[model samples]
Target: MRLRIRPASRLQGAHRVPGDKSLSHRALLFAALAEGTSRLSGWLPAADCEATLRCVRALGIPVERLGPGDLCVHGRGLQGLRAPIAPLDCGGSGTTMRLLMGILAGFPFPSILTGNAQLSRRPMERVAEPLRRMGAEVHTTDGHAPVFVRGGALRGLRYRLPMASAQVKSALLLAGLYAEGPTTVIEPAPSRDHTERLLAAMGATLERDGEGVTVHPGPRLRPLDLHLPGDPSSAAFLLAAAVLIPGSAVRIPGVLLNPTRLGFVEALQAMGAPVAVAVEGEIAGEPVGTLTACAADRLGPLEVSGPLVPRMIDEFPIFAVVATQAEGTTRVRDAAELRVKESDRIAALAAELRRMGARIEEHPDGFTVHGPTALRGAVVHSHGDHRLAMALAVAGLVAEGGTTVEDAGCIGDSFPGFVETLQALGAEVEALEDPPRP
Candidate 1:
């Protein structure tokens, strides 16, 4: 698929993005482990979340779709999940595979998890190693996917993460629920706490002490009702488009305002972007709020590193787009993890942005962008990454001519209605079938 985007003088409107992806994934998994039926409202019905839903149903859990973003998961209890008759195909979702490994580690059954070519290249040892320490036999193909986990007796152990990862931390914590004793994870920096928050809401015995989190083994989880807020990562693209185009103003309602996920918003404000956040309320222990962004005359340079990297890790691709319109150099460091994503985002962003005439440099850990450059539209590739596809589309909105992003159908992985949403905000964008090679 190809997405052609033309320069838009302004984007103006009020929009509401889909439910938070991270929360949506956890909600389904937690619901499947609860003792009774769990009702979820505003769940993200994207490709990635669908991979999780498929896996749970394969495990004998009954999941019903009440509406577009509404679901009711009839859990099979912690020890009630039946062994699957076939291998679990996780599609392209790393979150589904890693978190599911944790859950399977506690079950006394053998399970094999696999994915597509992209996900197959992603390392699974970050999760497999910890589960191994807890007495689960886990094997991977050269540290990549096609993970084979043989469940047995699990004994909780204290482990310190080599790096900060919400997925890895959540995996360990989830596996801890089936261990013989308390499982504790110490992080070098704080990652997203959606897992810890949702677990606590489900009546799991867990505690957060500074950089360390501990989870106690439980026989069952209490099902509860939840309403997920709009994803902050998805909201970043709308906010970025609003600020970069002159005379543009966008209001995004019911966005998740989790402090851990607000680094991008903070970076925008510090760079002099006209952005405001108002807290509305809390649902399922996560903050909910509204974000309003308007066009700005100029944006200043900003530096991001260390603890801040994990907080805004998923937003860097779009942040690179915003930097191109800023006044000075924006430096991002300590984000080497970008290399292991669906695409090597550092290399992908640097190469594609350069094609659009942006002054950018790539590094092992991060990238640097020198801005206020006059960009001209050129063809770019999505490299099968959802975030990269959306960020490139944002770049096209400010370019002088039409920009076509190749293989953009991958956007369905996270944001299913991304193009439609952009069109609603007055952007000239369309999805077209890619032309065949001569």
Candidate 2:
């Protein structure tokens, strides 16, 4: 797929993005572990979340698809999962693979998990090593996927995470549910807490002790009956479009306003983008809100590091686009984790953005952008990364000429209606099937 975008005067309207992907994954998995039928609304219908749904079904959980964003899961309690006859394929979702390892660790059977080529390259040792400490027989293929786990008796572990990872933390907590004692995970800095929030709402015994979360075994998780909030990460691209294009104003309502996930919005504000946030209420123990962003006359530079890196990690690709139009240098560091995503985001962002005439430098950990330079349209590639595809599209909205983004089909992995939403907001963008090679 290819996305051809032309410069837009402005973007306007109240557009709601898809349900939070992170929350969507946790909801389905947690509901599958509960005792009764769980009805979930506003669930994400993207490729990644679909992978989790498929894995849950393979594990003998019955799920009914009521709508595009709704589901009914019949859970059979903590130890109810039946062993799969074949290996469970997770598609391209790291969350599905890591979280499943934790859940499968306590069952008295063996299961193998595999994924697509991209996922197979992602390191699973971070998750596999800890599951091993808890007495689960876990083996990874040279620290990658095609992981094997044999469930059995387990003991709780007090493991301190070497880095901040919500996936790793959630995996351990999920495994803790079946262990003989309390399992605690300590974080270097807080990551997204969707797993913790959902676990507590489902009646799990969860404890929070400054940078640490402990989940004790033995509580029956209650079924979730709640509507999930929109993904803030997805909303970031739209908001960045508004901020970059002159005379633009856009609003997104009912977005997940978790502090750990709002770093992108905060970064925009620091860079002088006129972004407004209002907390309306809570859903499933996570804060929900509306966000309004308008065009900024000029955006200042931003310097990101430390704890803030993980919060806005996913948005850096789009943020790199915004940085191109800022008045000064925008530097990002401590985000070496970006290297291990579906693509090496640091190199991809730097390479693709530079193709569009931005002055940028790639670093081993992050990148540096010196901007306020006029951008000219050029053909760019998504590197098979969804966020990179969307970010490049936003850059197209402000560039001088038509911008073509190649291999953009990956955008459906997270934001399904990305092109349509931008067009509805009055951005001149079109999606087309790529021409055959001669």
Candidate 3:
């Protein structure tokens, strides 16, 4: 699972990416929990999302396929999800794990949730500790997965989030759907609200007050028909590729522009990249737009801190790759959340980038990059993180020699067809199935 990508002319094209991963997870899960049939189109048919569909189906909800990328979810409604006989394996999806905890807490079943080794390492305590506050019997493998959430009586309580985490916030909100009383969660800053958006679209009553969000229980969730927009996080790699090579212009059509997810686009603009966001329309009350980027001068180091950190959580790795080509230094702090992702991203990014000769330092929370850099080809590992794989691909696009990435397939968990999309835009990539190492 090694990939070789060589430098080419400006990575150029007008392309549409796969559906947003965050939205797809919440959409299907909520659809299964709502009353009647909910039809979903433009779904991301990837490993992680498919895992959600499978696990929910295992919980006794009948989910049928309409097409390759479409699904019809037959929900058992707010109080009707059947408990699975075995453990609920989430594969490598944290969204499935966290949000499911929130959802399962509403049901009165004792269940176990687990995932792959990579996901097993992620912090489940973020959701575990909160759901416990709502009066659900929740436990975890210390701070990691193998979480047992015994669904029973729940009372929604006001929660102040310790970090800027949409998954944690959304989990609390989703669980709130089943509480006899109202549930509210406050974030220090805004995180993605696709959960709130989808919840409202499904006829659930949800309101935002200041930095906190509240949802009332016993609201009937109606059926929904949706066209999910492309994921900007997945599209960030191509946009980064276009910027690294001069004379490149690429248009990404119909991507989600939720304020919670647009921090990456803003960072590129601040770095002087030629970036344009065209409002195409709206999907499920979330802003949908096309993002265009062109090659530009070196990006300057950035200060990624405070409120801006949560909005761009998923894009930080590629942002780090982009930062390597920028002048000066970039410091990213107040994002200790990075440590809880598929891997210790801050440390992994710094280690892998240093392997390619970038001067970077890792901190407990985040990292700093010293750049306006030049990278030579190197053997890099993805640490089984999808974003890491995508970041390495960008590293190859701007490196002196072609870079070889092991575990490139990890990107399929979030961004399926990632290699094909980049190759279609003239990137030189060869997918190789190298022999397994001892």
Local accuracy by lDDT, each model: 0.94, 0.94, 0.88
* Residue lDDT tens for model 1, 291-379: 99999888999999999999999999999999998998999999999999999999999999999999999999999999889889999
Task: Give the per-residue lDDT digits (tens) of candidate 3, residues 92-187.
Answer: 998899999998988778999999998998888989998988889999998888999987888988999988788898899988988878899988
Q: Tell me which residue pairs clash in candidate 2.
A: none
* Candidate 2 lDDT over residue span 1-438, tens digit each: 999999999898999999999999999999999999999999999999999999999999999999999899999998778899899999999999999999999988989999999999898999999999999999999999999999788899999999899999999999999999999999998899999989999999999999899999998999879798999999999999999988999999999999999999999999999999999999989989999999999899999999999899899999999999999899999999999999999999999999999999989999999989899999999998999999999999999999999999999999999999999999999999988889
lDDT-based ranking, best first?
1, 2, 3
Q: Which pairs of residues clash in candidate 3, taking residues 3 or more apart in a chain or in different chains?
A: 326-372
Give lDDT for model 2: 0.94
TM-score of structure candidate 3: 0.98
Q: Estimate each model's TM-score.
A: 0.98, 0.99, 0.98
Q: After superposition, how far is residue 23 of candidate 1 from its true place, in Å?
A: 0.7
Stretches > 4 Å off in candidate 1: 435-438
TM-score of 2: 0.99
